[model samples]
Target: MISQFFVLSQRGDNIVFRDYRSEVAKKKDGQEEAPPVFNVDGVNYFHVKVVGLLFVATTRVNVSPSLVLELLQRIARVIKDYLGVLSEDSLRKNFVLVYELLDEVIDFGYVQTTSTEVLKSYVLNEPIVVDAARLQPLGPAAIFMQGTKRMPETAVTKSVVANEPGGRKREEIFVDIIEKISVTFSSSGYILTSEIDGTIQMKSYLSRNPEIRLALNEDLSIGRGGGSIYDYRSLSGSGVVILDDCNFHESVRLDSFDMDRALSLVPPDDEFPKRDNLKLK
Candidate 1:
């Protein structure tokens, strides 16, 4: 369980702080320079960085490191989803909203709900929108990109509760097929190893909560060699793609997956990964 939660700026300023259990002492100056996770006087610290700010949690009990780290990340994402932009200025401007979110997300050091949709009814304060243009550039790279003809930003940055000019919520959903590929080559310039890690991410702004149907390639095969689970064709063919393993969210239905290689489900109102850890070859 979390004993305390806080946000620190890059310069070690405590921007937002909450002591649920009051088990940990007040943070000392320069504490932000410590490692992401550390232990001092039987107290454990876990923190995650997002947009140059630190989201930190403290505890005395021995909790799962991964679980605490993921909680920090999810908390950061929840704040970003509400504020539309995550920065020190934004957090300062919407501190009331932030505190309200913290109250709903955690109950006296115990996690309640991190889902943005679930928190909507409980979070009474409206977020103060931050103008992305007025903020300082993230880094030198951001300045360099300003002159380039970049594609329009995706809906991911928009707040889930934001309304249009006529108080109408846009009915749209976004699906992203993100993949990371790794390749190793021998000194002879021959490929020694190649693999792909992919995920299907989804975010919904639709109010009706309509069911979604997502179809995969007909020639897609699972596993290696001719003994693949889905297809009988050889994997050496150019048109065929092979996936060694994949996992889906609990909300997904696989009734037609065996025959049509399709997935059906009603997406959650907030952003979530529909599929994860897809190993491809």
Candidate 2:
């Protein structure tokens, strides 16, 4: 996130600072630009630069790289904890968003272990919930916040006989299959929360596991009734899913009445398989 700071004077002069950094130049004008100064509210000041502000802002931001990695790890950890077991395929499924969030933090100048290793470790060991409020509701109940639609399906039942003819119970197969599936789940509620610093927080349960690897033919919606709100289709712990056609209304706003083109954030069709990965062991 791009941050900005201001240097202001009480009378009327205000200085806004954002980033900070070191200088490498010959001593010109007999001095080094007074460390790139700025004025605050009326006082004449200097010694401020985008890079310098960045340093100060980073300290103030206080979001450590390790914390970011830990968060990513915890996301995977949550899935494992809830499922009571872990699988490499499952880890791979959820790593997409975890990696994206980690990249967001890395752009802020912090570093952590590779996202893959972090997820691996998380699966091996449960992650410590940093903010209970962030994880207020425990178990599957917490994640399933919205109502879901029972997509129509054709279930077929069959049984297979064992090779040994002595006397073995046949294996039965229950196939709840469908040619087209539309998993309709929606959430319109939020939980009020706050960080340690009293930051206003809002969270909601999602009725879908957003982490499953699937090819969504549409872009993720963000706001209310936007279809991509919590992004349940892309995260872990979201419940049952179905593949369906994706269409968008022509008339809609992007962000607060801002004119922006809707971009397809979904992965390419070739990148995702045409079928579900889950199968009975």
lDDT of 2 at 83: 25
Residue 74 miss distance in model 2 (angstroms)? 10
Q: Quote model 1's TM-score.
A: 0.83
Q: What TM-score, over all chains together, does every model reach?
A: 0.83, 0.16
- The sequence of per-residue lDDT tens digits that candidate 2 reaches over residues 212-239 is 2222224322222333424443653444
Position 174, candidate 2: lDDT: 24
Candidate 2, residue 107: lDDT = 41
User: Which runs in model 2 stand beyond 4 Å of their true positions?
Assistant: 1-109, 112-118, 121-125, 128-281
Report how far off residue 37 is in candidate 2 (Å): 23
RMSD list, candidates in order: 4.7, 20.8
**Model 2: per-residue Cα lDDT at residue 163:** 16
After aligning candidate 2 to the native by TM-score, how far in Å is the CA of 107 from where it should be? 12
- Collision pairs in model 1: none
lDDT score, candidate 2: 0.28
User: Ten consecutive residues with minimal summed lDDT in candidate 2?
Assistant: 154-163
Q: What residue runs in model 1 are displaced by over 4 Å at the alpha carbon?
A: 31-33, 131-151, 225-238, 276-281
